[model samples]
Target: MTILLTVLGIALFAFGLLFSIAWHELGHLSTAKLFGIRVPQYMVGFGPTIWSRVRGETEYGIKAIPAGGYIRMIGMFPPGEDGRLEARSTSPWRGMIEDARSAAFEELRPGDEDRLFYTRKPWKRVIVMFAGPFMNLVLAVAIFLGVAMTYGFATQTTEVAGVQKCVIAQSENRDNCAAGDPVSPARAAGLKAGDRITAFDGRPVKDWATLSDRIRDTIGPATLTVVRDGKEQVLHATLAKNMVARKDADGEVVPGKFVPAGYLGFAAKTEIVPLSLGASVDRMGDMIQNGVESVIAIPQKVPDLWNAAFGDGERKADSPVGVVGAARISGEVMNLDQPTTNLVAMFLMLLAGFNLSLFLFNMLPLLPLDGGHIAGALWESLRRNIAKVFRRPDPGPFDVAKLMPVAYVVAGLFIGFTLLVLVADIVNPVRIT
Candidate 1:
């Protein structure tokens, strides 16, 4: 049964991936058509076409390999000097430029002269290129907000889970109540487990982080508004200064890093709790920031990735996960001994994260990416404006075809990195268990 569920989970993840790819392409297709740019093919994958049908001027289809997708817009790249679309070049770099320019016009129809993508205004071209990644971002935001506001997140609440019998400095790394240990404030104040702290000194607190910060910053006498047995009650306690683990900006305790802070003597209860729309947006913002940071840190992590892939190194939990790794995790998530809602939430969150990563990856202003084309259009716009300011002749469209060589190099590096990640995923996969 577990094996069957795992297979089913993999299939489901693949379907979701295909849908995301198709949705990304659909953005390009729709925006291109809206701008009167002729798109010949809207493919949801690479390699040979598995299924296809003619829709208007476009061949909409799914390819056998469900890796990535594209939409072939007519005249994606501008022509060379003297309208040289039929250039034959022996130079390798020149061949790449010519090849890209030639492929852009291969599907040119009888009436596609005015409908070419490069013929559109710079702003229109920018929108056409930006639409793809924007769609992924939209999908990511929708999924994240939906899950966060409805299914909720695993969060530490203001409710007390446990009360310590005696005060022990967090830096001491000991749990026992020793002979000379002081009585904990919570225990001395008669604060028990299951008590829901509503406020700190009449200042209403909704989350654990706020309560913790308040407790940490406080010393001497303090009052807590708590609810016990369906009745609101006030508890008086003297917060004690102790050596506690220092908390980072995100309120996560830093291990092995101690500082003098007021100790509250109670642990927050953790549970799944839904968030408001404002809180959901804040959470989404954090996710976006973290995703950006992860992308920025990828280069620095290459050595560690290499070690984990080929050496007898530990595959850290925070290691980068490729498609294979993610799918395997999805399978494991499906087979986890959890409730149905929890499992579905985990799977959906994984899909949402993939979409978010897609948005970030494709938005890189390098060749062969949606961002590269957008950058080209923006650069073109900048040049035309500068020319107009100086009263010079129009510089015309920036030939993005000239950057084909650069794009090739970028694509090669990306492919190599992807393959490395793929190998690591297969050999030392990051597992939930």
Candidate 2:
């Protein structure tokens, strides 16, 4: 049964991934068509075509590589100065200028009035290119809203729930705090499980962030004021340094040396609240923003992840995973003896969050990405306008093909990283129970 469930989960995950890639490419194709741009081909995946069929003016197909998809548009870049246009009745320079103009005005084809991509206004072109990423963002928001409305949302309260005495090392079967796991700082300072931390070191502690900031910023002993049984009381405890491993939102370990840190082994009381339509939308926006911020911060946090994976006696490279990792996780979640609705909701949330990360990563203004093309388009537009105003020859559009080398380097790095993650996931998958 487990084997069958795992196989089914893998199949479902692959289906979802393909659907996402196709939808993302469809966004670009649809927008281009709406703007009257000539799309010669719309294909999902890359490499040699596995299957293809021509429909009207567009060739639809699938490629062997399942990495991504694209829509091939004519005159995507300015024509080279080969003087080929001069062979025709029109002057070469005049033809080049007309092609540039036609590139911008979606209404005009190559031979028609100057309506090329280059001729279109920058803002319009920006919108057309930006629509693809925007669509992904929209899909994420929809997924989040649907899941949250169906299963409600988890809300953590300030009240403390439980405190575990000793932190166990799973690999070595040793207690991290062998000396009877000294009383938690909060408990030692007179705060009980139900106590609400109202303030720390004389600063107001409104939420988890405030409480964590107070603890981390403090060098030594501190006073914590808590509301217990409806009365505020001051508790005193000396903060001791302890080593703790940290993981990012994506479950990747932060590479770094272990720093002696204040320890607090406490869980918060969390409740689920059914959100109103407006609240769901607001929460979805907040989640999307948080996801974007996390994606932007990944590069900076890589070192920390590495440290946690290696320094904490955890295998660093064992955490890498591809679609197989997603399948395993989803399968595990499904096998849990819980309400199917909850499981489905969790899966949806995970998918939405993952999609948000993928969307943001692809939109980075780097080579071999959708954002790179958009960046090239914008740069070319700027360069051409500047040259025209200065009465100089057109500098021409930014050639995305020129970034092939950089794209190759990025692809190599990604391949290596994916393998590493896959190994890590197989050997030491993160589990929550």
Candidate 3:
């Protein structure tokens, strides 16, 4: 049964991935068509076509490999200087440039002269290129907000789960209470397990973090409103100062670091609960920040990923996860010892994370990615505006084809990194369990 569940999970994830890829390409296709740029093919994968049909001017198809997708826009690059599409290359680097230029014009139709992508205004070109990654971002935001505001997420609530028997400094790290220790403020206030805190010091507490922060910053008499047995009750207690684990701005405790703060002496209850729209947006912002940080940290993680794959280093939980690794985790999530709703939520969150990763990854301003083209357009627009202001001759469209050699190198490095990640994923897969 577990094996079947795992296989089922993998299949579901593969379908979701294909849908995501297609959705990404759809953005480019729609925007290109809207701008009257001829797109000859709208393919949802790489390699040989598995299924295809001619639809108007475009051949919409699914390919054998479900790795990625593309929309082949006609005349993606302007003609070379000297008013010609043909190229004569005497060097290898020039060959790369010519090859790229030739491919960009390979599907050029007669009427495509005016409809070429480069003929469009720079800002329009930017929108056409930016649309793909923007679609992914939209999908990610929708999925994240939907899951958060509907199915909700696992969170620590203001409800009390357990009360400390006595005051103990975090540095002590012992469960047993010492005779010299004072009674916990929670115990003295008669706060018990299952008591749901509604307010602190007359201020309504909507979440655990707020209540925790309020407690940490206050060390005197305070009022706590609790709901026990469906009845609201207020209790007054004098909070104590103690050395507790220091928390960062995000309210996460800093490991191995303690600071003097107000002590509440009780652990918050953890449960899956829905968030308000405001809270969901706040969470989305945090995810975006974390995603950006993760992208920035990729270069540093390569060494660790290589060691984990080829050497005997243990696979860390924070290790980068490739498609294979993520699918495996989805399978594990399906087989987890949890309720069906929870499992579904986990799967959806996995899909959301994948979409978010896709958005971040493609937005990198490097060749072959959407952001690179957008950057080129922006640069072209800037240069053209400066020339117009100076009453100088138009410099014309920036020949992005000239950067093919650099693009090739970037592509090679990306391929190498992807393969390394693949090896690491298979050898030392990051597991949920």
Candidate 4:
């Protein structure tokens, strides 16, 4: 049964991935058509055609490989310097440019001169290229907000989950009390696990963050008003200075990092609470920031990934995971001994995160990606505006094909990195512990 469930989860993720790819391509197709450009083929995947049909002027199909998809826009690049489409050459660099130029006109037909993608204005070209990544971004935000406001997030409350017997610095990383350790303030004040804190120092405190902030700001003594067994009582205790996990700008505790703060010696209870729109937006911003940071850190992680794949090195939890690893994780999540709603929520969150990563990854201004074309269009726009101001001749559309050689190099490196990640994911997959 577990194995079957795992397969089911993997299948579910595959469907979600295919849908995302098609959705991305749809953005390009719609925008291109809206601008009167001819798109010959709209494909969802790569390799040989598994199913395809010619509709109107375009061939829509689902290909064999589900890795990625594309829309075949006519005249992606302008004619070569000789004022005509170029042919293949013996020189590899020249061949690269020729290949790109050739592909741009592969589906050229009657009346396509005005419908060519390169013939469009630079601003319109930017929108056509940017629409794909923008679609992924929209989907990501929608999914994240839906999951956050529906199934909700586990939030910490002012109710106590546990009371420490003695104060042990968080930097020590040990929960058990040791010899000569100072008695915990909560324990000394007769605080119990089920006690609900109503106020701190005669001020009403509704949530855990406010209470925690007030507690950490004090060093000597504080008053806790708690409701125990239908009776409200005030308890007094002297708080001690101790090392605690430091929080980042987002108020999330950073692991293996500590700072000196007043210790209350109690654990806040956690409950599933639906998020407000403002709170959800804040969390989304934090996610985007973290995603960008993770992308920037990928180069540094290559060595670690190589070691984990072949050597006995431990795969850290923060290590990068590819499509295979993500699918495996989805499978494991489905097999977890939890409620069905919880499992569904976990799956949706994973898909949402995947879409967010897609949006960030494709926005990089490099060749072969959507951002690369957008960058080319913008550069062309800049040069044309400068020429117009100086009253010089219009510099023809930027030949994006000229960058084909560089795009090939980038594509090769990406393929190599992906293969390395695939091996690492299979050999030493990161797991939910």
Candidate 5:
């Protein structure tokens, strides 16, 4: 049963991935058609064609490899400097450039002269290229906000889960109280498990964050108004200064960081709680920022990935995951001993994270990616505006085809890195368990 469930989860993720790829390509296709660019091929996945059908000017199809997808726009590059498409060359580098140029013009129909992609204005071209990544971004934000605002997240509440027997500095790292340790303030003040804190000192406490902040800000006397057995009670205690783990804005402890703060010596209860639209937006922003940082940190993680795959080293929890690794995680998530709703939410979150990664990854301004084309268009716009201001001749569209050689190198490096990650994922896969 577990194995079957794992396979089902993997299959579900595969479907989600295909849908994401199709959605991404649909953005480019729609925008390109809207701008009157002639698209000859709209393909999901790469490698040999599995199935296809020609519809009007476009050939829509699915390919054998399910990794990535693309839509081939006619005359993606402008003609050469001489105002004519260059002939095939025998030199290797020249051949690379010519092949790309030829592919861009492969299905060029007679009327396509005006329908060529490069014939569009620079800003329009930017929109056409940017649309793909933007689709993924939209999907990510929608999923994240849906799960957060509708279903809520597991969050800390002001109710006490447990009270400490004695005060122990977090730096000490041991929960067991020593014989000479001071009695915990909460215990001494008659605070018990299941006590719901209604207020702190003179301030009304609506949530755990408010109460925690108030407790941390004071080192001496504080008043806690609690509700227990449907009755309210006020308790007084002297908070002690102690080394404690620092928490982030999300109320999660920052690993390896400690600070001196007033200690209350009790654990806050956690509950599944929904968030407001503003809070949801704030969380989405944080996710985007973290996603950017994770993408930036990929190069640095290569060594660790290599060690984990080939050596006896333990795999780091933050290790980069490929599709295979992510699918495996999805499988594990499905098999977790949790409620069905929680499992479904986890799966949706996984898909959302994958979409976010796709958005961030393709936005790197390097060749063969959507951002690379967008960058070229922006540069062309910049240069043309400068020429217009100086009353100079129009420079025309930037010859992005000239960057074919560099694009080839970038593509090769990406392929190599992907293979490395594949090997690592198979050998030392990251697990939710």
Candidate 6:
């Protein structure tokens, strides 16, 4: 039964990812069509066409690769030898220059000059190029808002419901707590389960963040104030170095033991923030921004994120994941017996976050990306205006073909990074508990 559920979940996740990719491409296709740009092919995925059909001068189909999709607009870049301008009867030099100009435009079909993408104004071109990433961003916002409305936002509160009996600590020596070892500080301080922590180190804790900040800043020993069974007590405890196996964000492992300095063997109490409609929207926006920032910082701060997550720095290569990982996680979520609404809410948030990352990553201004095209269009527009001011001929559109080498480098890096993440995901799959 679990296996079946897992399979189902995986399938659903793959479908969702594919749908998202298709939706992103659709944004470009629709906008281009709206602006009267000719779209010859609307393909989901890359490589050779797996299934396709010609309809009204467009070949709409699915490709073999399921990674991403694209709309082939005539005149996406400057013209080449095979472009329309080259076929015209003209001098060799004139033909060469016109060919370059034509290649700059996405191509229209033979005798279909009316539908050419290059015929559109620069602003319209910009709109068509921006639509894909814009659609992804919109999808993220909607997903986040939906999840927030359904589950409410998890908020930290000062009221603690439980204390840790055994905590994981970092140590090269044998004295550190191992797996299943009882947390020494809480035990030594006579703390028990169901204790309500009210303060730490003489500071009134209003939330987990405040308590954690205070605890982490304090080194050596500290006093823990807790209320148990209607009685308040102050217990002395010594902070120990924390160590455990963990992975960094780039999926690298940094193995070592370090002290957390001031530490408390306890978990935070979580409450739902009841948000008004406007507040919910605002909160969702904030969440989206934070999500984007985290994705951007992943390469640099992955180690810290891994340490925070697993408690030990053991960077592994397979920590990053692709669609396969998403499918696996979704499958696990679906297979849960009597899954709570909160669990589903968490999954939804995860999806939203993943989508947000996808949106941001694709927006990076590099070749073959939506942002690259947008950048190219903007640069061309700027160049054209500057040229006109100087009474010089337009340099035509930015030549994407000229960026082929750079694009290859980017593609190679992407593939390499992707493979590394895939390995990490397979070796150490992240499980939501």
lDDT of 1 by residue, 112-166 (tens): 7999999999999989888888888999999999999999999999999999999
Q: What is the Å distance of residue 299 in model 4 from its true position?
A: 1.0
Cα lDDT tens digits, model 4, 87-197, are: 668999999999899989988998889999999999999999989988988998998999888878899999999999999998988988889999999999899998999
**Displacement of the residue 39 alpha carbon in candidate 2, Å:** 1.8
- lDDT (Cα, tens digit) per residue for candidate 3, span 322-413: 88888889889889999998988888888888988998999899988888898899999999999999999999999898888888999999
**Candidate 5 accuracy as lDDT:** 0.92
Tens digit of per-residue lDDT, candidate 6, span 1-433: 8888788777767677777888888889899889877788889988988899999867899988788888887765545545444455456545544554555453445776666665567788878978887887788778777776656777766665566566655454454456777566767787776676787876667556567666667656888887888998888888754553343442223576243355556656677755567867887767767666766766874554345344554433334556766677787788666447765776676677667777788788887677776777788889999999999997776655556556667878777767655554565556653
**TM-score for all models, in order of appearance:** 0.96, 0.63, 0.95, 0.97, 0.97, 0.67
Model 6 Cα RMSD, Å?
Answer: 7.7
Of the candidates numbered 2 and 5, which has the greater lDDT value? Answer: 5
Q: Which lDDT values do the candidates have, in the order given?
A: 0.92, 0.65, 0.91, 0.92, 0.92, 0.69
**Model 2 lDDT per residue over 160-265, tens place:** 8875454332333354567655555655555568888787777887666557545655656888777888898887866655565444544334665344457655
lDDT (C-alpha) at residue 327 in model 1? 88
Model 2 lowest lDDT segment of ten? 80-89
Query: How does model 4 score by TM-score?
Result: 0.97
Better of 1 and 5 by TM-score: 5
Tens digits of per-residue lDDT, candidate 5, 13-60, equal: 999999999999999999999999988899999999999999998999
